[model samples]
Target: MPGFVALTGPPAVGKTTLAAKLAAVHGAQVFRLREFAHDVRHRIDVDPALFATEDPLGWLPDRTVRVLLDSALGGRGRNGVTVLENLPGTIIQLRTISEIGRRLGLPVVVIELTASDAIVIGRSLVRRVCPACEPDLDADPHRPARAAAADSSTCATCGNPLRRRRCDGTARYELKLRRFRSRIPGIRREAATLDLPYQAVNATASPDDCLRRVVAALRSTQILPCLPADLPSALNGATP
Candidate 1:
């Protein structure tokens, strides 16, 4: 059975970037839950007013779960792994994904990236997302070259013009942080019960540093294959 990894973290903590990096290194497919949610919202023809009255997840249609599960499990026979990005925020979602993994006979691992609330909020305030390349860049007061490019509203990766997402602002980010904090204990408990391989990587470091730590953790946990011979020597050192 091929391996599957589900990554969870607070908003602006770099979960998407880590998932993309892992997928590139392991030649895996990615299933991003945020994108799945958007697809669900569009497919169901949801009323815009409903979002004002209730939490989006509260009224999530059943088809959303089906589509996400199918995408996560559909290519089971393939050689490459599947990397689920930002899924299973709640214990219920975790249990559902766990049951699906067990039924499909796929080995599942969960990795959570963590950072201080201040760092998350600061990054959220400065981040510019690239829709085409799916990497987030710090727009100001960091990454001088990238910041300079971002000043012109161009993405460093794909040269596409960058735009601040609606949910990236202060009010929404605070809400996301609160939600993340509330879910941590339940996620930890459920992951323990399911006996899933779980690891937490500190995400307060530089992106390269965080990637090295995550790669080391994955290798140590046997979720990812061992590093290639030609890979960087820095990765071979203990995860910082």
Candidate 2:
């Protein structure tokens, strides 16, 4: 059975980018948790009211999403890891995730990326992710990333049209940030109680540097066994 590595962080903390990079290196399965849940609910025609909240699928009963969660837990190969992005916030949601991991015979490790609120807010204001590639527009060497993202037609790396999610709006970003900050302490407590490996990485650097730091930290903690062999060159390629 494959284990799961779940990534959670404030808006614009680079979870999507890091997950994509790791997936490429390890042949890991990646899941955007809420998005997958939303699609599942939509297909089944569940209560429309659930879609009204910022995160509609996070609190759904495990029974409702058992098959979807199982598919996510099942990796491509024996050693492949499952990389989860945008993990739900809240102790109840955390417990639900743990239960799913337990039932699947997969260990779940939660990786929380931490950055200054100011940095996160600035990046949030600037970025609009590429739906296909999950590339970070904020990483472009351009000023006023929002304006750059708006002017751009497609992802520079993948040529996919850029899309703005609800959290791209300033008001929604602020709301999400506040909610995430408030829940961090409780999340840490609950994760500890669950005996889950919950780790935090400071991610306030250039994308390459931040990725390097994350890989280094996880290696030191022995949490991620399926790391890339050429870590220095692949992850630290742009570290300065």
Candidate 3:
């Protein structure tokens, strides 16, 4: 049977980080939407005559996800949990994505990361660079360097400041809410069908505490057959 776990929430809630930690513990494959977009962004260049647009989701992430889903289910040795990251935009779109998982017989679970608005706004103001091209800065993509020059808040290699990019206006926020609604139902549906619990995580807590909470949640739900020995260290505070 196919299986899926989505790490979702308003942007900058530490979904990406949590996803990584979960994947590490479960030995799962992580499919990050941003990474997928970044990898293929250059390949789909549009000409000026075609009335181009730079909407990251329009071409890259959406396409990449569809293709990835097809390939992952079609491929062999895909027994482990598959973590889908940064998936929340529109309600209809999210439902469509969840349906895809269901059609593939994937046991789906949704984990919504929650943090205070202050934390979200603060993190969103930080400028994070693309990790694949700027790994020297930091392995965590959300914490990119602020500058290329050596500074108090910058990476030594690239000097880029680590921060989250804030989206202007209520548009993005509204979109996020819609996505949440869409997945909330999917989570309930999955729980009813598979007899597995859905989870919500508070990422603002102490690293150890947060990991403990996640591990506890997973254990209480009986999602994991056995807790991994290294899970504690893996989820403890990531790179600064």
By lDDT, the best candidate is 1
Error of 1 at 48 (Å): 13
lDDT of each: 0.67, 0.66, 0.53
List TM-scores for all candidates, in order: 0.75, 0.72, 0.61
lDDT of 3: 0.53
Which prediction has more favorable TM-score, 2 or 3? 2
Candidate 3 TM-score, C-alpha based: 0.61
The regions of model 3 sitting more than 4 angstroms off are: 37-68, 72-77, 93-97, 126-151, 156-196, 231-240
Local error of candidate 2 at 79, Å?
A: 4.4
> How big is the positional error of residue 108 in model 3, measured in Å on the Cα after superposition?
1.2
Supply the global lDDT for candidate 2. 0.66
For 76-189, candidate 3 gives per-residue lDDT tens digits of 214656667765343333554566666765555666667777666565555465333454332223433335454655555554444433432346544544555556666556
Greater lDDT among 2 and 3 belongs to 2
